[model samples]
Target chain A: MTALLTVDRLSIATQARQLVRNLSFSIAPGERLGLIGESGSGKSLTSLALIGLLPETMAATGSIRLDGTEVIGAGERQLVALRGPAAATIFQEPLTALDPLMRVGRQVGEVVRRRLRHEGLPSSAPAVQTRVLELLSRVALPDPERLARVYPHEMSGGQRQRVAIAMALAWRPKLLVADEPTTALDVTTQAEILALIGQLVREDNMALLFISHDIPVVAGTVDRVAVLRQGELVEAGPVSDVLQAPADPYTRSLVAAARTFDTALGRLF
Target chain B: MNGTAGSMPQTEGKMTRRTIPLSLIVGGVIVGLHLLAGLLTLFWTPYDPTAMVGGRLAGPSLAHWAGTDRLGRDLFTQILIGARIAIEVGSGAVAIGAAIGVTLGILAAFATRTLDDVFAAAFDILIAFPTLLVAMLIVAASQTASLFTAVLAIGIAGSAIIARLTRILAKRVLSMDYIVAARVAGSSWPSIVVVHVLPNIWPTLIVNLALQFGLAAMAESSLSYLGLGAPPPNASWGRLLQEAQGTVYTAPFGAIAPGIALVTLVIGVNLLADGLRAFADPTRRGRR
Candidate 1:
């Protein structure tokens, strides 16, 4: 009934130049929103601003309300308090997203313990470990016991991404912001990771801000789509409407580019 | 295919064995022997290190293996005591440097732009001053030139280099994506430092500190040679070297014994540092 995240005329600027200007959007609770854009299109910056984690050099003027807390100029204490419980982010590179020095289980266990504490539940070592393994298994990682013992470098990319996902889910946050999460994975692994994200979001009924440049991947993952170019929102609507009949020339070009690949694949087959 | 696979692992095993860096072994043995000698002196030496129990300028003999100095103190006894002092100065200085430097470096890494710049400038200024000069100044300011003062001065001087290194390493780690993830996961700053920053930086820090141990030992000796080290009744290697300076042709053993000890210890420490670097770096491990 209420919006999980609201961005009002969000404008982000570095000292030299403006990166995102006059952008507005809101995602209702449990809604899936795909933010489609090219590199430097300000999608990542916007996501960062949502959690009040913008780089120090960059400034944001717009208001970002996450479950009613104004994040634009919030104190670090407030932002930190809200970050894990309000929104959890999955970055582009899974290997780098997880601390390489730490074992996967401990990383996930940290979040699980925090979440348990946040929820006022008992978070003893055994309890925290159980939740960690459960979340790891929930992400379709087999032999959670053994996987927990290995470092991030020891795991394959997909496995690492799953560990990242497990960490994100450990918080049980209201919104999950995945920024090009599959971009670094191989093609087959990308599809698997995307499906995992989609299924997990559905099962948890968690709102998702799925950011990616790949049109098909975004299309298959999100319920509604918003197309951005050069930091401006060019188009926003249901997934089918935009892909089938894009109003903006930039949106049409993006759709056409993805379609061209589809047609080329069809011809090859 | 199966035969090749079986033999491939065997060859890989042999390669792994051979790849154990030679420096590590050599340095380990050398340091180990010195440590043994130092520890042995704790319970037993040929004679009281400062006592005139042996004949002056005597050559090596069963009673006194390294003969005796001009003071008629057993040379072997003095050398063993020197080993003890060397170990003490090395470990004490490095421990102090790491404690102070690591704290300052991590704090500087977390500092705001202006504050970080201030810290950087301070570190640079401190580093620009020669370590021995800084130690000399500290000794002059304190008006006392004992072993404690020398170690404290060397440790403080070395802190700047360690701090500078730590700041750079910490900044690099802070920029990594996992650090952002840690913050986003609500990790407190202290916890982040303890959990993420320290573990990530400690391996390289250890290697640098090992090298610093060698430098600190040398600095102590230099101070002693300049008449600022442990006072008389304590024969440090450098003090022995200084004492043997005038008697060069007559009894070369006096200079050679202590000189050999100092050089070997330094070489051993340097080799240990190099070996540690190769061992701790994961990228290098992969190549091997």
Candidate 2:
């Protein structure tokens, strides 16, 4: 079967510099792939391109097919239609992922209602509310019923990220792109969030495109990995082969950095 | 705050924690009395405030309180009606300004970067033009000096200020991550405006709205003072002030009565606005 997402010669550029250059990849149904790079490596740019949320100054070229639909050069209406229902993103910062004034229930209900409408299912208030609570429960949020009524500012960072995850899964999207989803989280919360994401991927049969800078985070979360350096995909393969037996010197250096940071943190404590 | 947040303290909601300020109480009483005077006019005033009741420019007495105007109408009645007109004009113009201005602001925010630049430049030009000048020009062109006309002129002029404020506020909101997340969550543009945009900017908007109330009252009064607002028979405080000016040496009460009313109301409302800004600070601690 054709892959769910196929990118061919994808290049993103601004006036000053090329952000991503001729990168190509594909993600099949239910597959877990990680895009790993350091800061300024265009990992986030690639993800934003997939969602059609690039900055106004940046221009993207090449084919980005989500299922059968082409993303690049698509009109806004079509991109809007595809973005939430077909794919959803869990942004990096939990604190800012939610509308502070809004009740958490309404935020999740928004996506639930949209997904329900898209699926030709009951999209009434009660139905959406039920589904929002269910999704919150799925993410293992504490007191899902009560959590829904409160504003995001009332929640902790971990709870907020969980709420974000619940919102992303409201559509049961075919592809889930979590860009450094746990980067802003505490270590324990990060583990819980990662595990929760892994569980959801399996349960929903989602094609995961998890993006992060930390080598170990990618190794733990995804099955296959694509390593990027300075807007170029330097290496990509199965998680075990590329990580345990890295071919590229750049990949080796990232591995070295990850290990040194871990050791340094351990020694400091 | 974090320690006790999630355990669900049902009564101590975060927003309700801030202690009400004394200015709010004081200002509320003054504004409340003015509104009460306006409402009481609907049923009764000591006498017809507009009707000729006693000697012109007469001083305060039990029969005709606050004395009489140039037309020999009851000064107290004129002041009460003036308060009503002031309230009406202030709220009416503010309503119109808010509706039109907020829409324009959000539109400016959602416009392309270049178009947004154009809007920003246009706003600067419009804001540079004096509000009273614009109101005067609009009233002159319309050529009908009535309360409604004054309100329309003032509203249109005030809209530019509101629009500028809204555009700045909405742009700041648009740049927030939560707004983007709402979009990614499949919220339509209208939903984003209502749910994400308006609420986030609401406290600041409220503060501006209160401040605009004072400004609008001043604009309406200025328009009336220029003979371009609430033409005779309507005792707008501004017209009352203007009429009392020529006879100031003879009887100071006519000028002094409405003058005190206007200053007190404007000052009260402005203080109320200030108190609201302080009270709405989300970071302030609760008095538990």
Candidate with top lDDT is 1
In model 1, which runs have C-alpha deviations exceeding 4 angstroms? B1-25, B274-287
- Itemize residue pairs with steric clashes in candidate 1: none
lDDT for model 2 comes to: 0.85
Residue B280 Cα positional deviation in candidate 1, in Å, after optimal superposition = 5.0
Report the lDDT tens digits of candidate 1 across residue range A25-79: 9999999999999999999999889988888999999788998899988998999
Residue B263, candidate 1: alpha-carbon lDDT: 91
Clash count of each predicted structure: 0, 0
Per TM-score, the best of the predicted structures is 1
lDDT score, candidate 2, position A94:
90
* Superposed Cα RMSD, model 1: 3.6
Q: Candidate 2 at residue A188, lDDT?
A: 74
The digit string of per-residue lDDT tens for model 2 on B89-111 reads: 98998898899889889999999
Q: Report how far residue B152 has shifted in candidate 1, in Å.
A: 0.6
> Where's the lowest-lDDT run of ten residues in candidate 2 chain A?
A149-158
